[model samples]
Target: MASDAVTIQVPGPHGDRDIRVSSPSRVLWPEQGITKLQLAEYMIAVGDAFVLANGHRPVSLQRFSADIDGEAFFSKNPPKGAPDFIRSVPVVYPSGRSHAQLVIDEPAAAVWAVQMNTITFHPWASRAEDTDNPDQFRIDLDPQPETDFRDAVRIAVELRAVMAEAGLTAFIKTSGGRGVHVFAPIEPVHEFLEVRHAVIAAARELERRMPTEVTTSWWKEERGAKVFVDYNQANRDRTMAGAYSARPLALAPVSTPLEWSELSDADPRDFTVLTVPGRLQSVGDPWEHFADDPGDLSTLLQWWERDLGNGLGELPFPPDFPKMPGEPPRVQPSRAKKP
Candidate 1:
């Protein structure tokens, strides 16, 4: 019996590769009726842009067993039976453990990921060649319960200013949800901890300037109806959805990049898998020159030292992480035993 499968030609740096996608008619996005084959086509449509932004990095594949709403898990390492084209790189986790993580180098690799039921691509801020020192400083502006995308936009606007002050050019993107991600191409001279501190310093500065609108509170209860500067995303092994990656939301939205001028008017819902390829064709990639000029962290690190002088110390790390030096208690403020 012949299974319902199809082979598609995906062009890459080497040449065109014939990739087979099984279950081509299987629906991945139930609401939009987007099938597995459509997802593969979407990857091919935006292949160049997607590879440009996410390639050469250690990427974690967000895979689903069924449709997006069903059981899902992250595949960091190269899964069994992965093609020779798909490579893996060694990375160190927060717990001092090291493991091999997958790296997507070209368009064919991305399409292959889609064939594996991968919905979202979470690439590390660092490149595969140098996993210890991050070449990108990333910040996630997460909207709280009462806040929304508009609030995230407002924070992103100010965050652009903040990055500019630190001598870094900011790139903006939708998180495919209500949040926004701001990234700056940085020199890979500093390790993840230093970059994390730099992010914290900038986050604190932004909070000071927009006290009512922004907060760096790691604990959700402490953050009101304000946008949270997710400083921890700058840490090692931490990642947000890479640009042009499709999120597993009902609408099948991609983490579309945006120009600063276009962000104010952009709506995330409009940048779905069904529409993003056309958007890419129309306006081109906003982050086309993202890595052209890399910025240093001198200014931001100075701010971190100054904040330290003012008694502003370390914040909580992700619960799964080992207890870091100088990190505050992991317990919630309300749950802590008072002296």
Candidate 2:
């Protein structure tokens, strides 16, 4: 370790390991006065839960060059000087290209990520071994303009009911912003496209039940004040903030897991890096049993087929993706209408 850096011992699958955190006094979250060492300690405090949610999965690191509010970029590939303990797995991207991405297998690896200046952890829905199939289906409840967290929360409640009808168990989490994320553990029987369709099915159903408050509109102009169900998040290589990952927002709020009962009264600002460690100690991880008894996506797929038969075909994928086979035009709705 350098004279300025601090070495902290972290426990992982391989037991205790010494990890050096450079620039321990450098402020990462400027508003909160959170230092680099404080972020590393936060990872250590929630290490087990963080690993349970993010480990053994290919992840992209959101690294900051200076402070959280400074220059930032995503590091999908392993940067130079990554330790032997840090591992990488090759995963296919939407462009038909393949490359190795970093995977955090234990708590110590996460601390190492903080040392690399990672503020948020973006883990894939699939495990590192089965990179082709997703065992988890994710839905991002993104609140559009004129909408807020409360709107997203209401849509999440409706989504939970939709999942229940399909025999799937749903888990809730904050998006570390003005949105929410809902996940359901599923057997790894379907590929990314199938999972994406399953998410679309769920989102369409929620929209049907609450047309005034929810929407699956591919174009932003049509979304209005509704919460946008970002089904595209299920696409291969796409990721969400890990359950216990910290966000680079003003308060350094964490993307936290929550029991259904707490959603109604929950305030996202309370779940920050400074407070989450103690919250985990007292309340325990709400997603401890999240992977138990993984459900099948058969019911959701059936819904997808039903929607197709009714004339709602494939929606537009992300613009960066190669134009998919049945996807609608990528043009914005207002512009597409122009002659």
Candidate 3:
């Protein structure tokens, strides 16, 4: 789209040269097609749309180090620090909407979207809603020290089953890391605090059932053999923003919407920026039929109340949200809990 078009200079150890770039979405192959700085520009441009569409004020991007060769950004003999580049510098947009943005650099992005009812095309897709409302919840699992890849896969399969038992439709994807993110869509009617409570409750229940293989412990040392179930991501301001591909042989690191079955033995790298369009060619936008992803906090809040509460028998999550000064307790002061 014209919105992403830009004329920029590519910087390298040798020298800097002018590069022309623009795209309907992202500048997919910056090293081969553009430069590192150019690709970063594309990331910034698309991200700007992501912000405005989700109800945020555009802000400047922080400068960070990245290597762009003609093949991929941080791929191919990546600089020692390339992997953490995008995240190393914080991305801050002016606050207004409790906006959340999608990560598009991997197939996992699509997989996460498809499993939840929140496909990327929704007005709320790829953006955060209000601090109270979140349209989706993700369970990020960590691998253990001696755990083999198969063990990680097994953990994902079991987690899916647990989510199903909770009446949640969750999809799984390779995190492009040595883990997986299980996504579930909920009605956006509750505040961030309530949804996270429900998430914690649900995660805790799952851990209780699978103490041998799963854990809800925030501290790694306490999590023994079990996979670390990170429900803290459900917190209002917390984000798992997507990362664009910096290399080819490097994992296809994007948010992918996935089928539950695929979670069993799927390759996280199968879905890359290059392959998605082709998959669209045959499968035709895998998430084409779903409603667009939601960014509204109000909707998320309502969903939390309705889906997480129990009526006849047992219950999950506290009925109300925790008082402000939420998570990472040291950061925000709780007026309601002052000593």
Candidate with top TM-score is 1
- For residues 146-228, what per-residue lDDT tens digits would candidate 3 score against the true structure? 65545667877776676666666665545555667666656667655566666666666667677788776655556677677
Each prediction's RMSD over C-alphas, in Å, is 1.2, 1.5, 12.3
Deviation (Å) of 171 in candidate 1: 0.5
Task: After the best TM-score superposition of candidate 1, give how far the Cα of residue 183 lies from its true spot, in angstroms.
Answer: 0.4
| Model 2 CA deviation exceeding 4 Å by range | 1-3, 337-339
TM per candidate comes to: 0.98, 0.98, 0.53
Give the per-residue lDDT digits (tens) of candidate 2, residues 133-177.
999989999999999999999889989999999989999999999
lDDT, model 2, position 61? 96
**lDDT (10s digit) by residue, model 1, range 1-339:** 224999999998999999999999999999999999999999999999999999999999999988899899999999899998889999999889999999999999999999998999999999999999999999999999999999999989998999999999999999999999999999999999999999999999999999999999999999989999999998898999999999999999999999999988999999999999999999999999999999999999999999999999998999998999999989999999999
Q: Poorest 10 consecutive residues of model 2 by lDDT?
A: 1-10
Ten residues in sequence with the least summed lDDT for candidate 3: 69-78
How big is the positional error of residue 94 in model 1, measured in Å on the Cα after superposition?
1.1
Give the Å error, residue 260, model 3.
2.0
